[model samples]
Target: MSPDLWSFALAVYARPDVEAACLRLQSAGANVCLMLCGLWLEQRDATCDDRRVHQLRQITDPWDRDVVQPLRALRLQWKEAADTDPLLKGMREQIKGMELEAERALLSRLEGMAQGWARNSKESSDWLEALAGEAANLNRDALRVLRVAAAGA
Candidate 1:
């Protein structure tokens, strides 16, 4: 629970069904990094509140929209051509790595944001819903798997 967000994210993401669930949620427009940060907070028993949520969005929105998304878009755009071109495939792989690094950086920022928050004794918080926002309904099954896996984390 005390693990840094990156480590926590890696551990939880490696669990069975987690990657597929995360991909589904991502395809539905959920920020997988934010959701992972939410899971970290949940595991740490941090209280979920509107102000913190707002702050998180503030920190995430610009970085995600400006940085991460572009890399993702580029990687996706190259996917079809990369399959036929070895050079393009290698470059696309690099973009994929960059995208992952961008996410890791975002998670570090999120962990820093929660540094002063105190953990509570409650068994759970409403973070998954709060973080998922509108995308929650679009992928309940994915969220369920993610939630269960994170709870174990």
Candidate 2:
């Protein structure tokens, strides 16, 4: 396994069914960066208690809200125009890259924060659920699918 969060995330995200499950969770208002962090923690066998969840959220939410969201918004805002305007299309691609890089930065920070945490034998599904909490639009089935994918089941 990779020693860093970004590489770990890339590996897990490429696993079967994970991409679709992540997209489903993302559409339901879950922060994908946080979700990826949760998986990273799981891979590290970290404990998934409420306090840890809260701590993780505190570390990630601000960067996700302030930086990543804005870039995503800008890229999305150009979606329609990008279809026709070649210049806008190029600019939108650049914004998309920046957004991904911002996410990578957040993952790096999250990994740093979690580096010294004690590891446990907790189930990855439990960690995933704890990190994800209860999103209004993420139904139980969707969560189950996510869990299955996270577990590589």
Candidate 3:
């Protein structure tokens, strides 16, 4: 793993909250593939040859096998209802148009990780931190949009 990647992963693993969140998120049947895939896509601009990418890819299988199926099932669960929910309709449309490059970028990062880096809890923590930070930023933006919508201004 490159120094940056190694450091990022280490930081992610160091934070107890992040570590717990990762495990909880995984166990809670959260969409790991989609989450990681989204992260990878979002971070592609800053990524490059690195060991972390490789390990990330390796982990994606569990997500592909265990997570996506259920999500797809749920997505179709309320097709009629979705028509009334613009958010659901937009989300469905976005999912349908999800860019493949983002998915591939995340898989590449995981795959690129060196063996030691991939196995290290500290390293994983660092990566999680980066992911969490990105998520937080997204939440902030979404909240801002929500506030604006709520204000009707």
* Candidate 1 colliding pairs: none
TM-score of each: 0.93, 0.87, 0.27
Model 1: runs farther than 4 Å from truth? Answer: 121-124
Candidate 2, 58-134: lDDT as tens digits:
98889988999999999999999899999999999999999999999999888888888888854332567777667
What are the runs in model 3 whose C-alpha is more than 4 Å off?
1-4, 30-59, 62-153
Lowest summed lDDT over 10 consecutive residues: which window, candidate 1?
118-127
lDDT of 3 by residue, 122-144 (tens): 22333323333344443444323
* Candidate 3 vs. true structure, TM-score: 0.27
* Candidate 1 structure quality by residue, lDDT tens digits, 9-122: 998898889999998888888889988998888777898989898999999999999999999999999999999999999999999999999999999999999967878766
lDDT of the structure predicted as candidate 2: 0.79
lDDT for every model? 0.89, 0.79, 0.42
Q: In what order do the candidates fall by lDDT, top score first?
A: 1, 2, 3
* Model 1 vs. true fold: TM: 0.93
In the order shown, the candidates' Cα RMSDs to the true structure are 1.7, 2.5, 14.3
Error of 1 at 42 (Å): 0.6
Looking at candidate 2, what is the lDDT of residue 92? 95
Model 1 local distance difference test score:
0.89
